[model samples]
Target: MIGLDPWSPQAPDDPGLTALLEDARAAAGDPVAALALADRATERLPLPGTGRTAELWRGLAELAAVDLTVARTLEPHLDAVAILAQAADAGYAVPPASGTWGVYAAEGPGARLEARPGDEGRLVLSGRKPWCSLAEHVDSALVTAWVDDERRILVAVDLSHPGVELVDEPWVARGLPRVRSTGLRLTDVPGVPVGDPGWYLTRPGFAWGGLGVAACWLGGAMGLTRRMRTAATEREPDQIGLSLLGKADMALTAAAAVLTEASSAVDAGLVEGEHAWPRCVRVRSVVHDACETVLTAAAHALGPGPLTGEEEHAARVADLQLYLRQHKAERDAALVGQAVADGMPVAWA
Candidate 1:
């Protein structure tokens, strides 16, 4: 894992950024503190496709390497910032430029949050929203609700409003124990619309945001592989250990290569319109496979000793397991295949 840090060569030579990352690593155990750290990160981390896309994603990976939960908390907040900036750029009425934010666009069965007309021509949201992660902690959020039977729009809402209620749902998942992703019950909750109907999903930044999550996944894989490499170095490695190490290195290297290329494509203005969705699917699919490969390899190479004894290692493994589930796996793979079959331009070299 020595030469395998994805951002080592391309990472900016900024001592302050390095120091902030060290601080984030140290404060990984506390979600509240991590939220504050994420707020500070918004000011320093560059937005994707801002000529510093590589640095922005590298910062995310560095955060995940220490703790996936912290990365989970920070990644959404960073994405919310980027989304808001995009909305502002498009002349949408965005919320005040402050506070930690979360993006809650996940739609599920049994819930149908809707937006409708309200006083002063503002929008009001009602019904229930599912999978609102960090709902009780963040100050505000960018949530997607149906504007009509056929259209969905993204709106920013104040989480602390009386109309916003955190539903009591059983969160029994051991992974990411600190970040509770629960349902929100909104009763005529006032919200500021972020963009035109359907703009959120269609925007180019959507793909960039998806790729940012992949960077975190790559980092999580890097974390597990780092431990595997450490154990191999500490003792005389067995044939199986060497084999797993080689397999993991190959997976990580491939994932990193795709991410680097995707970042460049984004900054070079190649990922947009018809290209954005397919590109995101391709990159996420690659990183997700790499994560799964490393997960299996590390488990076999390190055995259950770390799982049973090391708190940090166990948490990292469980957190990454759940985090990677964000990718829809075969369903998403089908999307990539469909895109390819539909004559989407793929620069296969």
Candidate 2:
């Protein structure tokens, strides 16, 4: 009910971003090229928050806007791994932006990275860490390891070093082959400690970074609206189609507004102050639901026709669907609701 234009005439844009998107798109056609280009563009991006770096990066992402969570996850200045480096430097006197980087923190029966002490008291990680996005390609990575049953350690590792082995052809996601994320086995991979422990999640940037992800989701939802509109317009005029288009339009319009306001907050250091967590939870959940609405409306409106018949449209939907799942889902929903009920400062007022 509280919304403005569906699309901002001047959200954020750059000349270089146009070239970067072009290169990125061309590179996306090849897995190897895509990996290299992501790093290249990341390095080329000015440091975050410098000259509207964050806003422009998110805007450029909307240009390609094919719902590619993989490339979006790996490439650009907003990358989690890259942001980790920035956080490390700002919080712990570490350099975050010398080269390409990744964050591999997932753990499980199949995705375990064990940490042990070395003779000099440095951290050494061994075992297999699954979900290492672009692990084989990135120059370095920020990894989380089990220090004990109840503790975890964050370490920075040079991926090219010995004892680090990328499992052969580990990724097979049909929607995001360009991301190249997969399981990797680390056998005594030496690493430098990032923080005392819990630094990764405790930092204010953690929540800010989570909001960055929501920006991507919102951008993708808006991008998908183009196809949704085309799908509705090409068909015989029907109430159902019109309704679906309206739902998709409103959902994306709401998402865009939230993202714009959230981005303004981030730029103003509001997210960096006391409101980080609740603000993050609220924006992520809201944008996540909006994206779902768009996806559903677009699907039901188009029926099985575009999903099965058209390759590009189908690929975008599949990619966005998979990418959207990265959000915490119902857990996040409950947590955000609780925050609001408890009166956290998630509202601008």
Tell how far residue 290 is off in model 2, in angstroms.
1.1
Instruction: Write candidate 1's Cα lDDT for 244-331 as tens digits.
Output: 9989989988888888888888999989997688879989999999999999999999999999999989999999998998899889
Which lDDT tens digits does candidate 2 get at residues 1-349? 1125442224234666566566655654354565555554564554444435455436434533633543564443345454555656666644455566777777767566778987555788898887777676678887889888777878878889888887865456766556666777889888877776776666666776666566667666666677767765676758887888788778767776776676666666666644577677877888889989988887787778877898667877777787787888888878777877777764455
Worst 10 residues of 2 by lDDT: 1-10
- List the candidate 1 regions with Cα displacement exceeding 4 Å: 1-12
Per-prediction TM-score? 0.95, 0.83
Clash number for each model:
0, 0
The alpha-carbon deviation from the true structure for residue 150 of candidate 1, after best TM-score superposition, in angstroms, is: 0.6
lDDT of 2 at 275: 51
Stretches of candidate 2 exceeding 4 Å from the true structure: 1-13, 43-57, 67-70, 73-81, 88-96, 117-122, 167-174, 177-180, 232-236, 272-275, 341-343, 346-349
